[model samples]
Target: MTLTKSLLLGTSGALLAVAGAQAADLPSRKAAPVEYVRVCDAYGAGFYWIPGTDTCLKIGGRVRIDTWYTPAKSAVQLRSTGGPAYTGVPGGGTASSTYTSANGIDQLGWYARGLLMMDARTQSGWGTVQTVVTLRLAAQTGLAQAGQLSSVPLAVAGTTGATIEAAYIRFAGFTAGQAASNFTFLPSNQYHSIWSPSFPSGIRQFAYTATFGGGISATVALENMGDLAAATTANSLGFNPYSATAATATAVAPQRLPALVGNVRIDQPWGAAMVSAVVLQNNANFATPGIQAVTNGLGPLVRKTGWAVSAGLRINLPMLATGDSIQAWVSYGVGALNYTAIPNLNANTATTANYTGGFLRGDRDMTIYCVGVGCASYGVEQAAALNIAGVFTHYWTPSLRSNLVGSYIRLTPGSTTRNTDWTNGGLSSATGWSVQTNLIWSPVRNFDIGIELSYARLQQSLTGLNGAAPTAVPCTAAAPMCNASISPSNWTGRMRVERTF
Candidate 1:
């Protein structure tokens, strides 16, 4: 009986132990902590992570607010400037009606600006693939206005889709989509001067790029064609040509094709160098409303084509650290320019000369160059723009840096002239230059504050103004209207603050 009882006790104990083990092995469900990546800078950092793959993701953005001060009378005069006669109302003028000034302080303003960028990449069995998207966001009231008591919204800032500044996909050694053009681009370099004044804007294009290792690459792009001068609303080469006609007819722009551009870049241990060319197609004789014409004509005449070629070099003085370097670039164009202002004037005569070096004579067609492409206005004419820019930068530390920049543009008018029933007009050769110096200090991580001082001089003459100044001849006995060929020059200064997340 004792033996049987012991056996039963042992069996019961063993069963109990097995039951405990089973209970402990039961699965328990719980949520895992979420993982994210973050960036911190004045330009704002991005957040990104792959959900199911090994690919890494990065996201970033920026917000900016700015204030400016200028002399009351220093603004550009709308009604008159020696370049083009104000046939309509006028454009930007003196700071009197446009800005607020108090206690010698010209004006104060703010802008809620932001940029968002996402980069995704993965290592695949075949090769590495990457995709990128960048955009800018801002409140309509972010931009300041001279006429309004407060600020007003800018229609163009966010009216488009998703603040798309750049979008592209890359595989192996090739990239395709919308991004910065290879032409006229400076690589692997950053300085205060690079961002001040007019920074190089991105463009939309279908491009192919080949990397040769060691910072050397070859690139080609087919991009949308337009003039830089059309930065203002409704002033682009794509505007309706009929709208420009004093008499209405049809609405047609100069070209319907894209531009072709290619570039080659080489980076050596000592410095970097790059060269590029672009070609554009132009229909010189198409007429459209609200469009400025290079010349006046009733029907479709000769086709126009334009082109641009540029090169640049940047060398690192071995003594100076990576932050300290010097760079320079030169660009020349011979056709439809991205930034030519169609002078507002009456082309009603056979030959119109501003009497400055500028002239718009009709038998010879006017040609504007764009990205190496050409757009012409029916006759044999040419316009050229030569630009030179240089900058030197010194980084006191990773968070602080200062730079000096100088740029010049020389525009030479060829045989371009416009004729109409009443008047004729054209542009004379002119030169403009700009110089800027700035100091950028980032007191905190992901935040930057800076002060900038810049000066610019733009000079233009009526076509006939190239010769000696016209004698002050009297137009009437009582009212002697002396034709003025000299346009006044302008200067500007700006201060800015930027934050990023």
Candidate 2:
């Protein structure tokens, strides 16, 4: 028994040693060190630390769909786009005068937009350095927005486009690149900007902001406001007055200075307030005969400057709801009507979506008229504008809310007749008002659905005829513009669905 047991134990030990050595010879595999993306709460939600870097980065986007309805024969619609801006007839400016169903106008408009945003931030000795880039792709059919001409006929089937909505860098006390103009206070609670009197132009600028503790700050910026879709023009920077069918085309002086913008602002837990001012050079050369002043020895006309002032206030009403507030703003401009959110004749751009703005057909920075074609006797007059816009937001519940937005704008065309271009009649002052209301539902944090109703109207002060007249002021049956005293307006409704992450 002893001999058998001893042999068995020795054999077992020998086999185990051999197996252990073989196992050790095989390759070893340790679990890979997982590189999990670390969350960066320092910059708010959706931000994470880029691998092996101190910078925090966030990438997100939104998808939005919009559908709107405008009644037929709405005066708010531009006539050229198949909407009745001028009261010549119903279904005016259609592709076929009486060819398409005889006399019917399109009533439905739709738009879809996809957007992408990227933000990166890092801490440095000077301060936090940040950069943001945003891009958008959009398509539209029909129309309901403001200042837009690409309606049923112009955009017939549909139109597609892409744009770099914003790209900017900020560090220490400086901001650079394309961003919202410093002179404006866009209402945060408003949905349809058509009812708001906020300058919608995105401007190329270099700005410096100085902080004086306690959430108070001052900013000054140099912006190229004149660099519109078109570079320069005779009137509102590059914008023209729609009423100036016959006004002489004053030669535009090349830009000598960029627009100057300055603002003082205070932000606190309860609310925010700001006061802003801007100055721009009027580059129009005023002489009697078209561009004759620049060519026919009239010498260069003295360039006048335009200016605007704005003030805005916001008050939080947390006592009513978690996110409720009221915001109001007012602006006054002399020969700088763009500040009042009025549409310019210049082609609209992403920065300044003037196409969606309220219309003021006659007011202009410098109205130029010649005694006759090629005549050297010309004159100039400065127009003025005043606007007030406001919004009220109330949160009925955590997931339900509503917004009311309204705006009023007044224009003074000055004491001159701009009948040199279209030979309409004496251009008089006008006023416009817009009101909109919306209700939104947010079932989820990053998703929203809303419906809005809007109405806008324009009134003319045919003062030259001593009253308001829908018919012609100086009516001449042979003239195309003989009936020029009509006011335009429209009512529209929209539904929006949006998701962001």
Candidate 3:
């Protein structure tokens, strides 16, 4: 008993000594436990360790629908369907390909869009990387109705497909894959004007963006030029069947749609402003491939290159509230029409024999400018054209808008003469103007109703060509006669409703 008690006391003394030593080492008070969580790259920045796995995801997209209507007296055919110069035509037949105006019946119509979007991302020490995807659904192919002529299909009635709109991988300061063309600048739009030429002007290309100090940024890319010329060439060579068939055979070139573009902006207390430029190759002739053989199958087939530059500004106007703003934009293009295809000079004629449409030459340019003011607008657009040529947009309310565009085109008329009539057929007065206006009301967030109207006029000075009534003014040289069928003017009208989700 004496030995056990002595040992126990010794052990107790050692424990007491150790406890006192630890208490001295500990902080003055009890400390709280720190928690740690994991984050993935997809979430974008600021990530902590997750319990398991190593990834992140993000999802976003907008669903929109458009509808419209117009007076029956208008020249535009609401139910018309066709492509390019041969637009307005309702049916697609080899014979109707040459008609400037459509031959379909007038009817009210509607189209809608359903879009789904998602993005997956991952993080690294350097930066974040993300893959984006978008799917579009519609009752009918909007491209066909919108006059978009791309080989790629964009819409389906009940299916899912990758959007030609924008599908790419982005990381650091670079973007690659099918992306928007780097030439457009006007961002505010409230009208559904027929003059909306660049509605979906983006192109699939590889691009890069770099941000400098301040609010300045730059972008560049390479595109496929829609391969219009190449397609024409292949069609002429029988490799493709999409080229315009004509009398003169021109070898369309494989236009390199490479575009170099950039923008610089300065953000001041007053507002933000930016300037941009883009250079891309376009087909010179819209008729057929570049013509080479005329009398003998020989000589050189030439193709042309085109480009455009633009400037835009958005002013918050300190005098106005944050919701109120003003915007301005302008774009100009030189040698923009690379419609290198030879015209089918003999299409409208009786015989099936093909003939050259014409050769485009000299400076071909286009210009667009607009000013807008609005807030609380349904579409969040700035300006709206009121149905005038060269006016990009005019919107008085959230659901009403309009636009009209005018153009002048000069080409090398075959045989120093014209071919078509009042429709601006031959080179005579290729100058044409079209007015498009739409009155729309979005009763709900994803639904809309609207009406559209348009009028177009073309003028030409005949040089020479076949005419039953020959006069001192050249004849039978390739120019069109002053016939009602060839007169240079047309009109269109449409009514429709749409829904989106």
Candidate 4:
């Protein structure tokens, strides 16, 4: 009996030891604590705190599709023997009696774009610190691709590319980096529309805004003036002459100082108003390896400065109709023609034919000339211009709205021998106008589709040398030959679809 009891006890002890060993070898089940994202309401909607950090961030983006049609893109000229025959000027141009092969024209085009944006903000002892970044990717076809100023043949019928639209930081009432200029006041339309007059789009700058304790405020900024240099240079006949006898012109010197800009604004429930101004410096230097060494002595060209002033008003008319408003602005510039939206002769025209008869044939802002056989000396002359624009928006329904937009520009070159040369070279002072009506429908939140119909006209003075001769056909039944002045009109249609989040 003693031997049996001991054996039983030993067997139980062995079983217990085996179970304890198995338990020690088995895996354990335990989870680490999770750090979940938290909503940040201190800012605005769509903001949340980054896990394990105090910084708050918001991510948003947009996708857009566009289609456009313009007569300027489609009109072509037909030529016959004995001068030129009057071909239909669908876009606008003198009917040249000179015949050549048929030229290709662009009548319709499409564009697709995607945009991404990031906004980050944090509260600090000084003030709210904020940063915004936006990137855009785009693809275009048809006329949109044909008009690009590219040196190399486009890899495809259209182009695909990316661009940094805006990247800026705001802290303590100071803004630094690339962003919209304060000179732009009450802009109410997307940049894709031609009815909107030219406004300083974007530039790298450092600016400070002071709040006057009411809805009123003031801003002063120092913006890069390099873009204006490009505008001035494009107009020079011999600025960067590729061949001899291109006219003795000078090149715009590199910018040495930043443009100065100032603005004063008032905002209230009834509406908003603003007055803005800018001072720009213009500098030029004699052409290097001078086109006419004997004509133009080697020396720096004349230096001049330009100025622009603008005033705008926006009035809310909710009593007339819900969400109705009117915005109007006028601008005047001297030596700063770009502010008038007519700097580059063909900057806005889409078709080559319309470009040929563009409002101004020579430089828009300034001109240079040389005297003597080879152009002995050079002088500078500045241009003056004015721009007027207005827009009215009316809400037809909760999801539908309509906008009427119009703009007009007048440009006059300085009275100088260079101006006369440009006149003989087929350039003259001109006026241009554009009008558009647009309708937009939004069926759901963050998504909208819109369509716009626009008309544009350009009338150029007859003071310049005769352009391409007109066909033998009489200008009218009462007279023979084409009219002295050239006036071209265009019809454009645009459609857009966009989604944002």
Candidate 5:
């Protein structure tokens, strides 16, 4: 029995040894390792590292819907444009930068927009190389996106538009492609109000930004002004050049040279301060009558350089609430009012065409009296303008916030005595002011519902023979009060729902 047991044990041990050796020689089938996505904390949130690469990418989008209502400022309904004398005037006459009391124009409107954005960054020898692209798809109805200076509502109703709102590359402090103009000093977040300029998609340009130690920096850019807004629009010349009115700008040459823009800025814990300047070439259209020429004189269509300067300050008010702040901006322009946020520029006709033209009743860069060069004392004199704006913001809670904003505009139509006379057919001096308040509730991150209220007044003078607002629509030959002036001082309200990812 002992012998048999020993034999069995020895055999079992031999068999186990052989099996172990065979298993060791066989190929192994282990689970493959996972390539987990890594979070990139170097940049802000919502960034992740691409597998097998050092680059970081972020993808996001925004959708917004807005409904708005605005009333005409003047209670008196004026005569229509087809009248015997008021031929070139806006029919029923337009009013504020947002809307006018024009016939067949909508006092209420709505729009929806979607934006898709992608940002990619990679560490580089110069710092971080980044590229960003944003696409905007939008639809408007019932006179949405109207910012005419005149009372005539634009024809953008029932329009759908698409554009690359942003497409830029940054490397070694150099920026290329379409981006925000460096000439702006005030922050853009306060745009959801009647006082501020319309939300801008940025200008097409090449720029460079230099950072000094301690949040100080400077930037310079060259922008394609001709294509910036509808600057090329016929007869529409704004003092902010592109913000110009159509009535005065019959002949405007394309902007051959890109606008030169520069700014100096400082940012600190308390707040920020900045100063910006721009230079643009204003070329006269050869086809324009003498009144639209750079010089009504016999000289060939000449070129005049227009310029603008702006300053802004922002102060943090942490004592009141988290994210509370106050900001102020002032801009002065000589033929470059487009640099100033005054007429609520309408770069895209499909979107909003508010800045100037007959649409803008009170503001103008060139005061054109008639078609001939022998029009007035100064057929084409550069206009000067000033724009002032201030904004205040407070957070009632983590989810609730409000903003108060106001703006004032003044335009000096240089030497338009004969040019702006009712008989001569032109616009004269103008002034405007507006106040806006917005309350927003953000129950969660990336989503918000807000409402904005606005009260504004725009006063323009056609200078009755005595120099003041006229009394009649077309200053009839007998009464000769000058085409009537409508100072639309009215209220506007807007509600919006927006989601961002």
Candidate 6:
């Protein structure tokens, strides 16, 4: 019995030892260390340090919805002409002669947009280096593309569009890539008002800003003018009698030089002020000077240069109320009408050359005319323009504010190069003005709702002053031809809601 007990004890001890040895040979279970994201306060709010790097990054975006209404007169004209159509009576007759009931007069429109932006910054030996990229997706309803003749659906329901608003880089006082120019100051009054001055929207360019102590800086840049002169000439003279001459004279000319832009700016406790200027080249080449028998032998035209200047001032009126301010600016251009904020003068669109005022009675930087047999010389008229805008803002409460804005623009074409009937009668001057007011409420951080009302008026030069002929339709006592000098005025109202982060 003693021998058996000893053997049993030895067997149990052997079993326990074998189990411990197996457990010791098994792999250990331990988790890897975590590298959590860290907040970065070095570069303002909303920035976080990238994992395992010193670079700071921020992501933000805005979503906006807008609804608006415009007068039937304006809407019909826009539908027929494809954009902001000239309001004066046509040479043949009144609105009845030019537009039909199918134009959908007095329409309401809505637009929704989503904007996304990413910013990355790092401190370098030279200075703080930064890169910014912004993208936009939009959907629209009830707004027709410029030049849609039929009542085709103008609304886009879903995210049917995308565009790059800005993509730029900055390092050591130098900015390169597509971005706003230094020439613009207080670019807009209310949200998306067309009456504001030409603010030189984002363009591909390189610029340098030099800081002078005391909140003063100067910038110089080279910007693409994008054949501005040729475009303006085409818009003024691309119809009927002048189409042939305009086509031959304003052929797409190669861009020889970029526009030179410069600005001086100062910021202070009171407000800010800036003076800006630009020089652009007006280059063109005639395609076939005397191709048609009627053109005679004129083939090539001379190249010209254009310039513009602007001055702006902003004054903080906190004494009146918190967030209160006033801003004013004026611009003058010679051969650069677009810089003066004239409608339909942008060079980016094919129909940009079309005028918002009526035909043969509006001004352009240049004009071309050919008439009668053996017309050798094409008219090349230099033009000048002026634009001014002012905005005043008042804060009723910490979360509520209102703005009043007004703008005026005038374009004067130079005297006819040729004393012919076509030159005299075909080209004239124009004046336009607009006023807008809006109230905006901010219910919470990064969110806003607003309402705006606006009015616009345009006046064209009278017919027959430049040897132009009167309308074919005779004047009636109720609406004399003389009254045709005024285009129909437009009134618009808008409501908007926006959220940002």
Candidate with top lDDT is 5
List candidate 5 stretches off by more than 4 Å.
1-33, 72-103, 154-157, 190-199, 230-252, 288-300, 343-364, 367-379, 417-419, 422-424, 464-485
* TM-score-better candidate, 4 vs 5: 5
Q: Give the TM-score of candidate 3.
A: 0.54
| lDDT minimum window of 10 residues, candidate 1 | 344-353
lDDT of 3 by residue, 142-233 (tens): 22233221111122233223344557788886777655445544441332322212324244567777777777777776655552222233
Worst 10 residues of 5 by lDDT: 78-87
- In candidate 4, how many Å is residue 178 off? 0.8
Count of clashing pairs, candidate 3: 72
RMSD of 6: 6.5
Per-residue CA lDDT of model 5 for 24-57, tens digit only, reads 9999999988889999989999999999899999
* lDDT, candidate 2, 200-294, per-residue tens: 32567899999999999999999875643212544321112232212334344567788888999999999999999988876555433244435
Task: For each candidate, give its TM-score against the true structure.
Answer: 0.66, 0.77, 0.54, 0.77, 0.78, 0.77
Query: Over the stretch 6-103, how does candidate 1's per-residue lDDT look in tens digits?
Result: 99999999999999999889987789966654332322234344665576677677776655433322121112111122211121111111211122
Give each model's whole-structure lDDT.
Answer: 0.47, 0.60, 0.37, 0.60, 0.61, 0.59
Q: Give the poorly placed runs of model 3, Cα more than 4 Å off.
A: 1-55, 61-63, 70-103, 141-163, 188-201, 227-253, 266-271, 282-301, 317-322, 337-425, 429-501
Model 4 error, position 132 (Å)? 0.9
lDDT score of residue 357 within candidate 6: 22
TM-score of 5: 0.78
Q: For residues 1-501, could you state the per-residue lDDT of candidate 6 as single tens digits?
A: 999999999999999999999989999888977878889999999999998787999999999888776534311121111112333333211233332221433256667889999999999899999998988877766532322111222233433577776788999999897777566676543653544334323666789999999999999998766623223333223222433333244434446778788999999999999999988766544333356344552345546677889999999999999889999989888876655554322211111112122233332344444444343444455567788889999999999999998888776766542222222234346667778889999999879999988776766544442355533544454333332223546567788899999
The TM-score of predicted model 4 comes to 0.77
Flag the better candidate by lDDT, 3 or 6: 6
* Model 1 local distance difference test score: 0.47
lDDT score, residue 318, model 6?
Answer: 92
The positional error of residue 432 in candidate 4, measured at the CA in angstroms, is 1.1
